[model samples]
Target: MLKLTDKQALEFGIQPVHHQMDNGELRFRLTRDTGSSYILTLSAEQSGWQSSHVHLRKREFYIVEQGWIVLALRQSEQLTFRRLGPNDSFMLPPGLPHNVYLSEGSVLHTVKYGSADADWEAAPELDEKLRHETFDGKTFFTR
Candidate 1:
């Protein structure tokens, strides 16, 4: 396994992709790809949400680097949500639908494996309520 420090990862550089959300700009930076797995960093310049999505053949995982992310996962017939902060990590098996919302100016590191290209099916309506909420350092609340 290849492990890299934050500085090392930065030195490797990233291909940043930006998306405009209703709330703010969401940036996804792809840093490494190893055919079987990809390493990337994501952040929201202001505040925004990533709609729920599922990858049919890849296991997805992420670690919080700065601020927080509210992660919601759906499996079987249940949906659960967790608020994660720095150093926190979570993973989801293939076929599970999950949503990740980053607090304003927050950062997250992600790893996607078991597939090369991402085949994501979006389910934004799954957590529509969260779309209107905002994170305020310690907690999330409706704005």
Candidate 2:
């Protein structure tokens, strides 16, 4: 994994054209012409949520670059919740139902591979409220 500087993150974040989903989530597509793989950065400020969906053809990895996030994963009939901070990452394989909830002002750097387009379903019925903390390498609660 690459450790991004503030300037690099800002520059990369500004490159892709972003759009809002039917659920009102906001994501910036960072990579163009990458062919079979794409990068995206999600914003909590826009929708207060992340990807509440499942991919059947590609694998998705959520890497926390800034702030904090509480991720919910439902695989096979089991559900789990995890709180992650900067540099922490989690992978959701194909056929797994996963949802990520942003902590007010969270930012997640995500990557999807092995598929050119997304074959997924958005899960709006699994809405949740997350309670967690962020570690910014300085003050834990000052973010």
Candidate 3:
């Protein structure tokens, strides 16, 4: 994962802060400080996984630009999964506990609507709650 500073993002004409997550995911904030609205881009390498968490009051929209990703979502004591590829999109409403696994060289454009504070609630033990299987280079999860 490539890490960039705010200055680097400006120099690169991205215009927003750029940073790397602890898991090595890269993010470029395209818009910010707009109160409940933000846009960003995220990139990850194969086998990379985003942390499991939920947004209390934010709705998230994702557009896959390259490669693919698998989303694991938990709802009403049930876990489900979805795989999305290039040009595919998904909108996640508030209160959904989820995590994402990125395929090789995946790039995603995302929009957050509803709260600027993130209201992020992390569920670190979520992985233990899933029943999953991997086949044909992809992983699927279910309760």
Candidate 4:
């Protein structure tokens, strides 16, 4: 079994991130095998204007484990936002623009299946986006 201790994980530089439209937290897990896959968690304390303009080559799956989240999805200009809480599993297909906002103290388990390349676009694009910023504007710099 893969047992990742908090100390080991933090020692490995596991850092909280500040993502678009969030003022909370962001954690990450990445695995590169025959399939390009990763697991990311987002916890939000603010509303989101987040989005994914990149199309996926494979399906993306997400489950809310902590609090709640709102997903903004665009289909041919038909915009929709869905609120999701714990025990919610959303599977998004390729080529769709989607963004998720984590509610207060929210935690999400997100994973992508198969080798997929997707462009990431969180609307309100900030060229000043410094990577490793926490959802709370706390910046954690990395190489």
lDDT of each structure? 0.68, 0.62, 0.73, 0.57
Q: Which model, 2 or 4, shows the larger TM-score? A: 2
Put the candidates in lDDT order, highest first: 3, 1, 2, 4
C-alpha TM-scores of all predictions: 0.67, 0.63, 0.75, 0.61
Among the numbered candidates, top TM-score falls to 3
**Candidate 2: worst-modelled 10 consecutive residues by lDDT:** 134-143
* Candidate 3 lDDT, 9-51, residue by residue in tens: 6574445657887867778766455434344545545355677
Candidate 4 lDDT (Cα, whole model)?
0.57
RMSD of each predicted structure: 6.1, 8.7, 5.9, 10.1
Clashing pairs in 4: 17-134, 18-133, 18-134, 18-135, 23-135, 24-135, 54-119
Which ranking of candidates, highest TM-score first? 3, 1, 2, 4
Of the two candidates 1 and 4, the one with more favorable TM-score, higher being better, is 1
Q: Write the per-residue lDDT of candidate 1 for residues 1-143, one digit (tens) a residue.
A: 99876667656553434454555544454534432444444464665567778889888888888888887777665666778899999987888878877777677777777865656788766667455555566764432
Stretches of candidate 4 exceeding 4 Å from the true structure: 1-24, 42-47, 116-143
Candidate 3: give its CA RMSD in angstroms. 5.9
Task: Residues 1-143, candidate 4: write the lDDT tens digits.
Answer: 89987566556545333344334466576644334455667655564434344445666788888777766666675656566778888888876776665556777887776553443544433211312222322321222
Using lDDT as the measure, name the better of candidate 2 and candidate 4: 2
Task: Tell me the tens digit of each residue's lDDT in model 2 across 6-115.
Answer: 56755644345577765555667754333233455555444344546778877878888877776677755566667788889998788777776665556677777766
Using lDDT as the yardstick, the better of models 1 and 2 is 1
